[model samples]
Target chain A: MSAAEDRLPPLRRSSGSVGRIALIVLGIVLALLLLVAPLAVIFAEAFSKGVAYYARNIVQADTLHAIWLTVLTAIVVVPVNIGFGIAAAWAVTKFRFPGKKLLIALIELPFSVSPIVAGVIYILLYGANGLLGPLLADHDIRLMFAVPGIFLVSLFVTSPFVAREIIPLMQSQGSDDEEAATSLGAGFWQTFFRVTLPNIKWALLYGAVLCNARVMGEFGAVSVVSGNVRGETNTLPLHIELLYHDYNAVGAFAAATTLTVLALVTLGIKTLIEAKGGGDPHRPRH
Target chain B: MAGALTARRVLPGFGPTMGLTLFYLSLVVLLPIVALALKTGEIGLARYLDIITGPRVLASFRVTVTAALLATAINAGIGLLLAWNLVRYDFPGKRLLDALIDLPFALPTAVAGIALTALFAPNGWFGAPLAAMGIKIAYTPLGIAIAMAFTSLPFVVRTVQPVLEDVRPEVEEAAASRGARAWQIFRKVIFPTILPAFIAGCTLAFARCLGEFGAVIFIAGNLPEQTEIAALLIFIRLEEYDYPAAAAIASTVLVAALVVLLLANWLQARSQRHSEKTP
Candidate 1:
């Protein structure tokens, strides 16, 4: 009886249906135009001058240096964040601890703080007159407006991704496998490498991919501390800004297109991993 | 035997874990926050109030929060529609469209700013048409709002999409079978389930827009009273070597963000409890 009732006739057509459809279509079209069209225009213009100009612009000394700096920052920020993620996940999931709730909130602090705030705090602590400034100068070490400053801010901005991803995965998996490994005479390190690491690897990778994207694309925080010293401190995003301001639209787009392609590639990898993980129940563990 | 052996081992538990967490937090997060608070403290409360309440800062606060709120509100409605369509409809290019939503997340903010500026400048493609109607976008508060909305749209869409997907269609079918109208079913059945997720998304987007800098600065033209956002104002202060003023402004944003985040977390917890009790 319920099955027959569920097959009731479809609703009658009304003028309101057209209006609703139109509204939804209009909203979607406007969003696509706003978000996708600008990038489209940039890509069109980049190729308008042929591949030679694109190649020349992207290979310029300053542009290349900026790209290198961006890559270096990603290299530094991603692995360290993954390590932090693993350790945090281990502590949070494997042990019942005091202040657990507070610690969880603290782990996500970077997510709530503005990138600009991250930059400001770094400046206040490491700039010429900052709290640690005098002490650092005494030791002849520099952080503000240097590579370390750039890396530090990037680290802060992308800090939450890995831990955020891995913690829940760890919690859901529980500690049965670790216990079994321990009973089999495995030490802490051995259990972690053999049992825990494999279970949370996908979450770890997902987090790393997300972290890399943010680190590569981060602008506000890096700009505040970078001093924008041309080849010396300009990352790819900063370089794009400077080039556009200098009326070098082609160069800016060339760099942007490169980053966009990188982003798409990472997103593809994430989708593939997620799909694979979904197909096999045990796959999420690895 | 296994239980006895496991119980016998001393796991280096809470003390080590808390110590490690605190050490990392202090080095990376708490210390910098303390420095910001300390710098603000140096300029007495009276002077700090003067800086925060000055005309320029006040204008920035009004503009940033107003634009963020407006954008987040718009996104909440539109993002829900988009999520609903994506989950319910079977259309060609659906996967492609879904992928495009994440473009803003992947695109660098500075590049986004530049691209938007080009598209909306007086001589640019779209600007040519809009300028005919005496509507200017680039280098205005309107342009700032548009940029903020563009970058922040994905946050709401992504947040609500999964929730919408999880709201099984069978309930809607059941409601319709009972002779309920479409709007009534949507209002009574679908709306309550997704409200918490929608609010969470809006809060995140609003917080993000308030702190946005790279995308706003290039298109805003950074005119002091007219288009300077709070984040850019902090940048200008730092550039002028006014650490105290910058700190004061930053602290204001920090406190505001914390309040919003706390409220959002509470709502999330409440929703979780509600679901647990019902389901």
Candidate 2:
């Protein structure tokens, strides 16, 4: 019935029926080819070798290690970024300060930077011949070409997600609630926990979800830094690259299926958050 | 004197939060940029120019910029169409189509890279038909543009959607009441309002394409002077242990990205101000 209603001509005509059909068909075909087809290809290739083959490939020790390392990186990167995000948002929105615009721009710097350049920045700072490299060498500390390097670059890449979400939200919500709470004899922590946290919780979680996805899927910077040792430092995306280069198409797609599942979950949560009225922070209000 | 003249804030966490914000910002962003600058500075200006202007480097820049431009052009058109349909029409699977626009952003670029490459490779689904017609997509600059377009697809669509939504129905109604045709209403009434936002979205999409790495590499085929992108070139330089050359090439890319980002920011701000002024 709804389909029949959609097929009916418009009560008020902005575009002709023929033009409308043409445009909708064009959009759908493009979405199918550009968006849906890639996902279909991943799942098809992943299961092409049979369910048993796919399962066996995923459970391999190296692949399992890659999964674990990827999870570990997300665990570390997400919460720290959440902290930074909250702090940055809190300071930017709740207070008047010097160089406020500059601070916001700086926070967004990672988003604009090429990930390979991000990797090189660290290399310039911590690689063997890097400025701090010699200094760190004397101390026998390793940062680049290791797990720590992976964590750092992931941090750089995802640093803005949470703060970017919250700053606009907190700004819109205003300081009135917190100010009222403070006047009512609430302490800082009490006001923040009871007032600010509750108000911004959904946006905070939305930001954290995005930050987590980026951390898990980050490739270029992590590739440049993580020496890509099979069981030692390879994250899931890096492992997929390694598998692909080795012509293990099934293994690569198999591992990719996991990240694919994560991407779907992220999209689901994003839609849910939007439905919950935590609407996309980046979208302008009507 | 200026600092002392302002009244104190009533907020409690300002000191601590600002402290943490500045501290972390320096460690994560500012310091690394400083490191980049220091390294680039170490390579004298003459050598820096020499490295960035080298024949291979110049070719990669040409390929990267050209592909990015092509991708941005496609994104501008398709994104505008998609956003228009999404905001203006209701179809059977409209909501699902809206949700799927973000797939490129959420999906790991490596997964996107391999999936796209498989689809466009000679024996793959789309590839077989196109190859029969003597058209090739994978392992060429065309593939690079397609990959760039895939990754940056959401930028223009997402940016334009809300702005389009904000174009009040009354404006169109007013035009319609005046006996204006559909195209006239759009071209005159609607286009003027959304132009700043549309341009902003295109600029941002272009900037993102310039920096895109993971999704482009697998399909790029990494030929030295032909299909290679700037980001890949920087990676190759790093692999060769030529730090100076890598830093030099990266400096150029970095500066371009920053400048483009600033321009996009300015355009977005202008759009916001424009919207506020409208109603």
Candidate 3:
């Protein structure tokens, strides 16, 4: 049923029923071509052999290691990003500040940056001939071509997710609740936990989900710093590339299937939260 | 500084939280971008320009810009239509289509790349039939554009959807009462409102397409100077241990991205100004 609020007066009647139908058809066709087809292709290509074969491809040592590393990266990166996102949002929205706009733009810098360049810059800082290369080498502290490198690049790529989500939500929410709680003699920690945290928890998880999604699926940046050392530094996306390059199309597709499933789970939860409608952080974006 | 002194909120943790936020932001985001710029600077102006403007690099730049433009153009039309439908019309599967629009945002880039390649590769499903018609998609500039279009599709739609949603139908009704036709009503009424957002969305999509590496590289077949994208070329430079060359080329993308981001921000600020004044 059309929303009565959205209904046009007879003067502004929609392009008749036929025009509406045409646009809906266009929308469906575009969605299928862009969204559904890619998803279907991944699933079909994965099962071109059989579920058993797909399982075998993913169960191998190298592939498993890639999966583990991807998850490990997310486990480290998501919380740190969550911390930064919360801190940034709290700082910008909860208090009066100067250069708040500049801070936000800086926080969102990675969003505009290419993953390839994001990787390269880290290399510039820590690679063999990088600025800290000598210091790192002397300490035998490996940053490039290691898990730390993967962790860092993923952090850069996803840094904005949680903060971007929380900032607008908090801005719109204002500091009213925190102020009230504080006036009632609530301490900083108490106000945060009792008054503020509950309000933004869903948004928090929402951002974490996005951060985790990007963490696992990040390719270009991680690929740059990873050196694609199979089973050592390869994340799931890099593992898929490795499989494809080795002419193991099935293996690649299988790995792709795993990441595809993760994407779906992320989408599922995001949709559920948005549907629940508790001050959805996604509202500002769309 | 004046605002901090004049405006007071009882909320605490600003100092601690903001301190951490600043420090972390510097470490991860600002510092890296600065490092990128600094590394490029260290190579000197003449050499950097030479490396960035070399024939192979120039050809890759041409391909990247052209493909990104093509993709952005396609997305502009389709995304406007998609946003219009989702906001104005309610239909069967509307929710599904609406949710799936975010799929590109969620899906791994490599997956989209390979999947598109599979669909358009010779001996594959769509590829075989298209090949019969002499329309080679895989491993061509068209293939790169297709991947670019797919990965960046959501930006235009998402950016415009909320703006479209906020527009009231009453304006269109008033226009129609004045004898405005459907097309005229949209052009004179609805289109003007969403124009800033549309431009913002298109620029965002264009920026994303410029930086896209995973999806396009898979489908483009990485034929340097023909279909090679700038991002992948930079990666290849890194692999060759030509760090100076990679940094120089990568900065061009950074510049493109910064321009687009500035456009988006300005458009956003304009829209926000409009929103604040609306009621």
Q: Which candidate wins on DockQ? A: 3
lDDT by residue (tens digit), candidate 1, A1-286: 2555436422222223554566457656866787668778778766768899999999999999999999999999999888777777778888875788888898889988878889999999998899999999999998989889999999888888888888888888888888777768887689888888888788788888878989999998999999999999999999998998898888888888888788778757766767757212111100
- lDDT minimum window of 10 residues, candidate 2 chain B: B1-10
DockQ of each: 0.47, 0.55, 0.63
Q: Which 10-residue span in candidate 3 chain B carries the lowest summed lDDT?
A: B1-10
Tell me each candidate's RMSD, in Å, in order.
3.8, 3.8, 3.1
Q: List the residue pairs that clash in candidate 2.
A: none
* Candidates' chain B TM-scores in the order shown: 0.92, 0.95, 0.93
lDDT of 1 by residue, B1-279 (tens): 557754644333445655666677778888998999899899999999999999999999998998788778777777777777666554556676676676777677887887788788898778789999999999988888878887887777776776666676567778887888867877888789878877877887887788888778878877888888999999889999998889999999989989888987787677666556655
lDDT of 2 by residue, A162-263 (tens): 998889889999988887788688987998899999998988998899899999999999999998899999999999999999999999999999999999
**Stretches of candidate 2 exceeding 4 Å from the true structure:** A1-16, A281-286, B1-9
Would you estimate the TM-scores of all the predictions? 0.92, 0.95, 0.95
Residue A131 Cα positional deviation in candidate 1, in Å, after optimal superposition: 0.3
lDDT of 1: 0.80
> Residue A112 lDDT in model 2?
89
Q: DockQ: which is higher, 2 or 3?
A: 3
True contacts kept of 2: 0.68
